[model samples]
Target chain A: MSIFSNLGIRGSILGLAAIVTGIGVTRSCDGGGIVTSQHRVDLTFWNGFTGPDGRRMLEIIRDFNRENPDIQVSMQRMDWATYYNKLMVAAMDQRGPQLFVVHASTLPRMYRSGFIENSARLYSGSDPIPSADYDPYVLQQVKFKDQYAGVPLDIHPQGMYTNAEMLRAAGIQQPPADKASFMRALRLLTKKSNSGDASQWAFALTLWRNNFQSLIPQFRGRYLKPNGDADLNNPGNIAALQFLGDLSREKLIPPPENGLGWVGYRQKKVAMVWDGVYMLGDLLRLQGLDYVAAPIPQIGPQPGTMADSHVLCIRKGLSEAQRTGAETFIRYLSKNSIRWAAAGQVPARRSVRQTPEFASMPVQSAFARQIPFMMYPPRTPVLFEVTLEIDQAVEKVIRGNADAKTALDLANVNAQRGIDRDRAEQKIAPAGGIQP
Target chain B: MQRTGFLFLAPYAVSFAIFVILPIVVSFVLSFMRFDLTAQSSAGFVGFDNYREALQDNYFWSAVKATLLFALMIVPGLLVIGLSMALGMNAMARGQAAVRALVFLPGMLNIAVTGILWQWFFNGEFGLFNFALKHFGGQGQPWLSDKAFAMPSIVLMSVWWTVGGTAIILLTALQQIPGMYFEAAALDGASTTRMFRYITLPLLKPVMSFVVVTTSIAGFQMFGQAFMLTRGGPELSTRGVAQYIYETAFNSYRMGYGAAMSWLLFALISVFGIFQIRMMRRPA
Candidate 1:
C-alpha cells in the first residue's frame, strides 16, 4: 500500500488489479479455482537496444510469446544514453518492468542500489540456464557477493578494423598481429605528399575511453582490481598511454579530436581503426569499402581487450508468477542469442559460439577470438564516478595537457576518493549491502 | 458568481500546487536530508552536511566555473547581436516585416535540432566548417574538442539559435520609443550621434534593463546547448552547474547532493537576478 501511494489513488487501484491478477492465476493452479488458457502472465521487459539490435530482440520476444501460450512478454526499447536514468527512477518508484537489460559492467551499481533481484534462485530451479555455457569472468561480473545479479546475454569487444584494399595496396597480405607488424603496416600504409603533409593516415583512435581501456589491459595493466579498487596508476597503463601519445606526436595517427575517426575510415583516407564489434554494422552498410575484422593487435606482453556484456536482469519485488515468467523469458532469449549476434554482438554462451552459424558471422566470429582475455571496467558500485575520472584522465593525456603517468596518477587519487565516499555511504545505510 | 470564478481558478491552482510548488518544497526538504534513492536506508536529516560537502567538492567548483563562463560569454553576445540586428531592422523603411521574420526564424527551431545541426558543422574531421576551410587552404579548427574553444563554440551556436527572439523583443521596444523626442532634438541643432546619444539612449533604458535581466537569467540556467554539443566533455571543462546537478542526481543517484546543488544554483540565480534589476533600475 505504501509503495502504491507514490502512484496516486487511481494508479494504486490499477496496481491492486495487477496483484490480484497474479494471485488469481496462482489460485487457478490449486485445482478448484477457475483455470483458463486466456489467463496469461503478462510481463513487461525494457532494454536500451534502440538500434538494429532491437529488431533481433523483438523477433526473440515474439517467438517467446508464440511458444508460451501461458506467458506474454512486452518489451520497451530506448537509447542507452537515457535508459539507465529512466530505469533507475522507475525501479526506485516500484514502477519498473518485470524484466530489463543492464550491461554486465553496470551490475555492481544496479545490485547495490537494491533495484535488481538476486538471480541465484533462477539458476538453481528445475530448468536452469546452463551456467557452464558462460565464461567465468563474464559470470563473475553478474555476481554480487555469491549471489547472481543477472544472466549474461552477449559480449561486445573491441576489434581492429582493416581496409582490405589499403592492406593490399601496401603489399600486406594479412592483418598485423603484433607491435612489430602493426607499426610496419602503419608506416607502409601512410602516404606523404611533396608539401610535407600526410594526405592519407595509417590509423585513428575512435571512442578514446574504450580505445585506451583496451590498450591498458594489453600492456598487462588493469584499470580496476578484482576487488574493484583503482589500479590505473601503474607502469603498464602509463606505457599504453605513451604508445598512443607517441603515435599522435609522430603523425602516424590523427589526433583524438571530434571522435569521428570512423569517418576517416569510411572516406578511404585511413587504412586501419580499432573500434568495437558493434560498429561492424555501420561499416557493413558502406557501399564500396572492403574491410576485415580481427582481434586487436597485441601491443603488450600478452593479448588483452575490453569487453562488455548485455545482462538480462529481473526487477526486485515481483510476484512469483511474474518472476517465473521473467526467468523463462531470459532463458529463451539466452538460448536463441545467435539471432542477437546477427546485430554484431558475440553471444556469451560458449555452445552458441561453437555453432557453425555463429562462425559464419565474419565480424562476430573474429572478434570472439579474444573473449578469453577481454576485460570489463571495475565492478564497483561507484562505477560511474570511477569512469568519469578515467574519461577525464584519458582525455587529458590524448589532448597533450598532461603525460600518461601524471594523468593516471590524478585519476587514481580521485577514483580512490570516490570509492571511499561510496564505502562510507554504504556503511551508513547498509540496507543495499550484499555481504552477509 | 464568486463560486464560479473560484471554480475557474481551481484547476490551474491545483496543477500549479502539484507540479511546481510541490516539487520546489520537496527539493528544499530533500536538500537537507541524506537521501539517496538507490540506498536501502530511509532518508535522514543531515542538515548542511551536503551543502558543506558541495562547497569543498572540486567538481562542483569546476561546474560552477563552466556555468559562469557560459553566462559571461552568452549574455553580452546576445545583447550586442540582438541590439545590432534590432537597430539595423529599425533603420530599414522597406521590407521590414520580411527582414524581421527572417532574423527571428532560427529561434523557431527546437534545441535538439539546432544542437545536432551545429554539431556537424563544428565536428573537426568531417564537419562542414572544416570541409570549407580545407577548400580555402586553411587548417581545420577543433571547435568543440579543444577546451579553449568548446564553450565559445556553444555560445556561438546559442547566439545563432536565440538572437532572433531577443532582437525581436528589442525591436518591439525600439519601436515603442516616441518619435517626438528625436524630432525635437533634431530641430534643436543636435547632430545625428548626439541626438541618438541623448534622446534614443535615455528612452531605451527601461527596455534595455528588461532585456539584460531576462537574458542574464536565461544564460545562467543554460543546459541544452552544451549538453547537446559536447556533453560537458573534453575533461568536463564545458560542464555547467545544471548539467553537473543533473549528473549528480540521475547518474550518481546522489539525490540529497543533487538537490543541495540545485538549491545553491537557485540561490545564485536569485542573487544575480536581484543584482541586475537593481543595477538596471538606476538612470543610465
Candidate 2:
C-alpha cells in the first residue's frame, strides 16, 4: 500500500511540472502566432520616458493603435539611467524592440554597434516627414557619417528658469540678456544672513556639466581639435571655467553639493537656476510658485546653449513589413508631436513649432528661440567617457580643490588618453589618414 | 524511490547550471578576449591583455581604493553596533521579542527606499538634518557633496539599513548561551564585563566569525547604496569597483575589460576570505 501511494504521488508531481512548463511555452508562442496569423505586424517600442512625458507617449500610442489596426505597437518605458544599458544588452542578444528611442547625442555609439537602421530610408514611405521640415541644426544632430541615423522627435535645451517672486523682491523686472547685465543681476540678487552665509542667490549651478557646456560654446570653446584630439584646456574653455569658478568664489552661488537647486528655486530661496526645458511640466505641477523661463543668459561672448533630442530609431533585423510598420508609427508620432510638446518639450520639426498649438506653450517657445544655436557635446563614440572627464574637471574647479587651469589641463590629458585608446582599438590611423 | 528523489532535485540542479554556472564559465572565457560590443567584429583572444590594462589603469586603482575604504568603514561598524544591540536585547527582562522584531524591521525595507529616505535627510540645503541644525543656530555641512563625508554618510545609511539583521542573528546566538553559565560567573564575584568577555563572547565566537566574514563579503560588493546616494561622486571619490566595472562594461561596452576586473575583484574577496578565516579560527 505504501509503495502504491508513493507511485501515485510521483505521477501527479510529474504531471504538474509538465503542465506548468507546457503552459509557459504555449502562452509566449500564442502571443506571436495570434498576431502573425492575422497578417498584422507587431512592433515593440521601447523608451525611457517614465515621467509625465511617458503618459503623453502612451496616449499617442493608444491613438495610433486605434487608428492603425494593421500594426500592433507595444510600448515599454524605464528610467533613463539604466535604460541604455538594458537596450544595448537586448540589441546584442537580437531580442531588441522593433521600434525604440535614442538620444541624438547617443546615436554615434549606438550606430557603431550596428543596431540602428538607416532612418533616411524611412522617408520612402507614404506621408513621409519631409527632411526640410526639421530645423537644420536639429537634423544635423541625428546625422552620422552622411547617413540619417534616426528620426528627431523633440529638442530639450538647457535654459534659465527664474523665480519671479524672488526677482521682484530684488527689483528685477526682466531677466538678464547679456554677460554684463547677468553679472549685475547676480550682485543685486545675492544676500547674506547675519551669520555670513548666503541666504539668497542670483543663480545656482544645477547640472555643472550642462552649465559648463553652455558656457564653453558661448566662449567658442572647441572640445575636439581638428586632429581629433581633446582640446579641453583650450584658452576659451579655461576662461569659461574661470567664469564659473568666480561665481562660487564671490559667494554668488552655493558650493557644488548635493542639495536640489531646483527645489530652492521652487521654494523662492534662489533667484534663478539653469536647467533643461523638460522641467516645465514639473514646475507647472507645483502650485503657489511663480516661475518663468528665458533663454540662457549670454555668459560668454555670444548666444548659445546646450541641447539634446529624443530620436526615434528602428532596430535592425526587422522584416520588411515590420520595418514599414515601424516607420509608419514614427512618422505618425512626428506629425502629431504637438501632443508631445504639451509634456514640456520643444518639437524638433520647424513646421510643428510654427503651429498655433506649439506657440501657446510659453516655456517651450522661450527655449525654442535658442534652437538655432544649441550646441551638443562632441559627437564621439566614447562620449560617455569624455563627459565623465569633463564633469570631474568641472567639479574640481567649482569645489575649489583645484584652479581652473590646473584642472582643465589634467582633464585634457585624461580625455586625450581615452580618445587615443578608443582610436587604437578601432584600428583607425592616427591624425592624418587611414593606414595603408 | 531513488528515481523520485532525483526528479525532485533535477529542477534546482538544472537552474543552477544554466543561470549561475553558465554565466561564470562564459565570463571567464570572455575575460581573455577583446570583446568590445561596439566593435564586435574585432573580438579575438587577447590572452591576459585585459588583466594587464587593469593593473595599469589609474581609475581602476582609485575604484579599488574606494571599495576598500567603504568595506573598512562598514564591516567594523556593523560588527560593533550589531553586537551592542544584540547584548542589549539579550539583557532585556520583558518585551524582548517585540524589541528584536523592531530592530530587524529596517532590514526588510528595500535598498532603494533606504537610499532615497537617507538622501533627503542628508541634503545640505533643505534636508531634515540641516533644518534641525539651523534651528539650533548651527550651519549645515555638505554631507553628500564633500568627499570626506560622502562615504561616511553612505556607511551611516548602510548601518541603519543592514545592522538590524546582523543584530538579530547575534541575538539568536546570544539567547542560546546558558543562563547557568552567567549565574555561575556572577556567583564567583565576576563583574558584568568579565562575564561578557569570558563567558558570553567565548560561546558566541562561531556566530561572530560567521557574521564578520559575511558582512565583509557584502561590504566589498557594495554598489546600490553608493550608486543611488553619491553616484560615485563629489569627484568619483565614492565610486566602488563594482560601479566602475558596470560603467566600463555596459556604458563603455568594454566587456572583456569589465569581466577581467570582475575576476580581479573576486580574487580580492577570496584573499580577504582566507585571511578572515585564519584570524577567526579557534586555536587547535
Task: State every prediction's TM-score relative to the real structure.
Answer: 0.92, 0.94
RMSD of 1: 5.2
lDDT string, candidate 2, A1-436, tens digits: 6554766987878877998898767534533112454568778899999988998899999999989989989899999988998888887666778788999888878888888888887655567789988878788778776678889999999999988877888788988888888898899898888888778878888888899988887888878887678899998899899999888887678776637578778777788899999998889788888887999999888888999999999877776677888888998999999999999999988999999988888899999999877888877787888899999999998898888889999998988888888787788766842111
Error of 2 at B126 (Å): 1.9
In model 2, how many backbone clashes occur?
A: 0
Regions of candidate 1 where Cα sits further than 4 Å from its true position: A1-38, A193-197, A225-228, A428-436
Q: After superposition, how far is residue B275 of candidate 1 from its true place, in Å?
A: 1.5
Writing each residue's lDDT as its tens digit, candidate 1 over A351-384 gives 9999999999999999999998898876777778
lDDT of 1: 0.85
State candidate 2's TM-score: 0.94
Which model scores highest in lDDT? 2
Q: Give the Å shift of residue B246 in candidate 1.
A: 1.0
